[model samples]
Target: MNAILRGVRVIDPLGRLDAPGQDVWIDGGKILAIYHHIDAAGVPVVDLTPPDGVDPCVLCPGFIDLHVHLRQPGDDEAETLETGARAAAAGGFTHMVAMANTTPPIDTPERVAEARLAASNLPVSILQVAALTRGLDGEELVDIRKCVESGAVALGDDGRNSVSPRQLAIALAETAHLSRAVFVHPEDEEMIAQANGTQGSVTRSPIRPVETETRAVNLAVRALSHARSGHLHLQHLSSEGSVASLRRARHQGLAVSAEVTPHHLSMWLPVAEEPDPQALRKVNPPLRGELDRVALVQALREGLIEAVATDHAPHRAAEKSLAYDDAAPGMIGLETALATCITIGGMGGEWLATLVERLTVGPHRILGPASGVPEPRLRIGESATCTLFDPNAEWTVGETPLHSRSRNTPLIGARLRGTVLLTLAGGRVIHQDPARVPIVSEQVTSV
Candidate 1:
């Protein structure tokens, strides 16, 4: 089967193509051709004439989250692979990396295989990251080669930082030998004593200081120096000083990349002062001051921040209802990431294009398929992965409209501008507006 996506603009940052009024053709799960017009008669076409009252929209490569916890095989009450992938598709995401912090921890080949099999049934792509140590205890290293062969993309102890520098060095060395990257959660546990919110004068709560992140980064960089084969990727960096340290490491020619979440870029810790703890403003690497927020935005604009990931960790209502110290450390982000990027991050069309590239191609280079810009017009002969969004459409978020099983999002009631009109993965329209006719799945394939 062949499908045509017509009358939509194409946006690819690396290719410098941000043009409108083109048609895309996908055949057998690969983009065959993209042009202003397709003359073939047998192929089915989906005419996407921009509604008269609505502004023009843009079509780009689907997003890929570098850090996510699907919580399958354990902790299903919070989220599962099937439900999480649905949430990812609703947010215009085509792929996501599942963190290694599962119930038993993804530390063995069998566990990695189980996760991949479970995720294979979903519409989107799910890549598992194996544990850096057995059971994530930071004691003994897992079988790096076997885990990678069993479908693990990388190795990491996502929830907890390794305790000993020697243990970390050994793991990095093994990963380097296997030609894989090691994703580090960059936090010095010693500094994490009862730290809840951001460390600043605006809040009376004692929060984890900036040194926690810097110390972990410095240690990871030094370990990389000894084991130079693998790259070090940092997750959810919040402080300005941490960014500076990463920039300096990159300047010195170390292989390093870092990601920032939307909550950190758009909100600050002052919101925690609200009387209602249920407001869902508090998060890990807790929201910083206005200064830190501005710095993070600047880093994104200046290329210091390589990617913007959701860290889409979901928790249940009961889990988030507890006191500040007792509540879980995450908020639902996959559903609202792009909207937050466009509305709050002040990203224009070009910047938005760059962000999409960072979310898809950039991360893909680090983990999965080789990096390359999605061709213009979204035609056939290319992988059938695309995201269609209304850039100027306005919508208010609420609990009833959210697709995630968990309703712990912080963006509820917030007026957002961009909206995902349709999302396709492997030539299948996993999510489409009910008002529009759905596209049939042409052909499906996965890595």
Candidate 2:
């Protein structure tokens, strides 16, 4: 793990650093130094200097995913802790907040400890979230204090809503005292069912309507406002209504935050002329109209949305190949999140820097110290947990080999511009694109 990254552009948004042609020295799992040149005696070097015509690779604090589904102690045919960690590392993420809505549901202290132990040796750090309610049934609350004491970073019932705004308020109030966040799915199933039962009051499409997201956002925000405590993080926010609600909540200082998925920000409904039997693009808080997509991008730009999580729910091919309504409601995004934001969301310059901040700084701020994780930075003495990526590397999705076990991304056939070149977690080389940034004796010329 001890090596030199030569001529890499360092961009730590939190540190206000954006300097190119810098050499970062890593020794003993800590950043030894970062300067124009580092003359080390025994440590090897990896030349990160781009070719004459290519843009230099960018290095930044390791990415943190606020929300991801690593189905362990459950659905192993789709994704395990090993595969999910690999995918997160491949996507340049050093830390991932794994959701609690698993097979048995991470609702107890023992389960939380088990999950933490499972990911202890993985490349990426897994911050386990305890379910807000037992079995995620939304009927009874889980023991919040015990779970947090057992290493649960946050509390959430992500796969389903909290049943009612009042119930969510109660949970939030409890978590507020604990200094932990309650990540809500923010989709009102009751409202959707009612809307479907009625006519003309709501969109009667077979697919879930935008009103579902909007109403749920309003309810969740109201719950936060009522609780007047705890951080309420809305997951996978879609629709312009949700944006307006988030704007008002933040304006009123409600201590609530929200995240948007890559697919929701990039794609829209009815992408194909015919029905998709495999339901590749189908996701809970499903994709909306093009207008919704545009609004989501603008919301993230305006800081209404704090993070861009993968919601990396993986499923087996058989589960994904079921009928549209019966298929799973997520896509594997750990390997494609950054590229999607850059290419599909069209982020660049200051905006691109802002996006990186969301991936690193914003999540850390929301999770706070209770998450039991340190903030990643590329500075002297900081842990050498960082990512290197080529923003101009264009390649198709499915054409490349993904580390994840599942392949449910809608962008499978599309071209993406950015690609991760290397990833370091705890000073260990977790993932490196061998063909692009191989470390060999010939390439390691000392200064």
Candidate 3:
């Protein structure tokens, strides 16, 4: 694992480092040193220096995805822990929070422990969250204490929205004692049900309107205020109203954090008609109007919304191939997240570092101080987990050769402006774009 990344730009927000043309030395499993020049006489090297006309690749703290769906313990055909980890590494995520909404759901202490063990060996750390309600049925609460004790990073019922703010408040009250956060899918289920009608598709109908999310956010914020304990994390906020609610909640001194998804930020509803209409773009809290999309981007830039999660839900092709109203609501994003954000998010200059911070430090905030997830920084003695990406590299999304088992994303055939060139997790080379980086081996001497 000893190597030096040469001529790369380093961006570590927590460490207050944003420098270019630095050589980062990695030894064992931690960063050894960083300088303008490191003697490569005796160590393996990865040439991060781009060829003429190309921008130098960026090296930043290992990206953390706050929301991901590893359809394991049930739907393996769509995604397994191993497959999902592969996709994550490919996308430059050193850590990801796996939602607890599987077949049977990870609602018990035993299941949470099992999920951790199942992912223990993956290159990226999979922090599994426990279901807020048993079976995600929203009827009964799970053993929140035992689940957290068994190593669940947070509590959530993502696939199933919270039944009521009261239910969420009770769950928050329980997690408050544990010093953990409750990740709530802030969409009013009753409103969605009534709006979509029984058996109606969310995308086909008027959809889960902005009110569905804003109302839930307001109620959840009030619930958190009443509980007066525990951190409340709103997941995949897609509307201006939701962002405003979060701002108000934070202004009131509530321990609240929120995440936005790549799809919601880049894409919008009233999807353009293709030769053949497809359900690939359908998602819960379905993409709002263009104004909402613009608001999300601005919120992210201003740090009002803290994290950018992929909500990397993977479903079988058959599940996604259904009619617009009947198809599953999710898109595989671990592989496309970074590039999509850079391109569609309009990230550049100072905002680039801000985007990287959201991907790294922001998720850690939602995990809470008690989760034991390391602060993502590159420094002497810090773990050598980081990502190197070519921000100006243009690549089009293809229909085949995807790392994820699912191909439910609407970005197929769309050209993206950025791509990850290398991803290192704990000094391990989990992913590398070989053509761009040439690995050299030798014995290292003093610089």
* Per-residue accuracy of model 1 over 211-266 as CA lDDT, tens digit each: 87788888888887776656788888888888888888889898788888888877
Which pairs of residues collide in candidate 3?
A: 42-443, 42-444
> Is 1 or 3 the stronger prediction by TM-score?
3
Span of 10 residues, lowest total lDDT, candidate 3: 438-447
**Better candidate by TM-score, 1 or 2:** 2
Error of 2 at 360 (Å): 0.5
Error of 3 at 223 (Å): 0.9
Pick the lDDT winner: 3
- Badly placed stretches (over 4 Å) of model 1 are 1-4, 13-16, 26-32, 37-55, 194-206, 268-276, 368-379, 436-447
| Residue 76 error, candidate 2, Å | 0.4
- Model 3 lDDT per residue over 296-346, tens place: 889898888899999999989898777777778888899988888888765
lDDT measured at residue 410 in model 1 versus the true structure, 0 to 100:
64
Name every residue pair that clashes in candidate 2: none
- How many angstroms is residue 48 displaced in model 1 relative to the true structure, after the best TM-score fit? 4.4
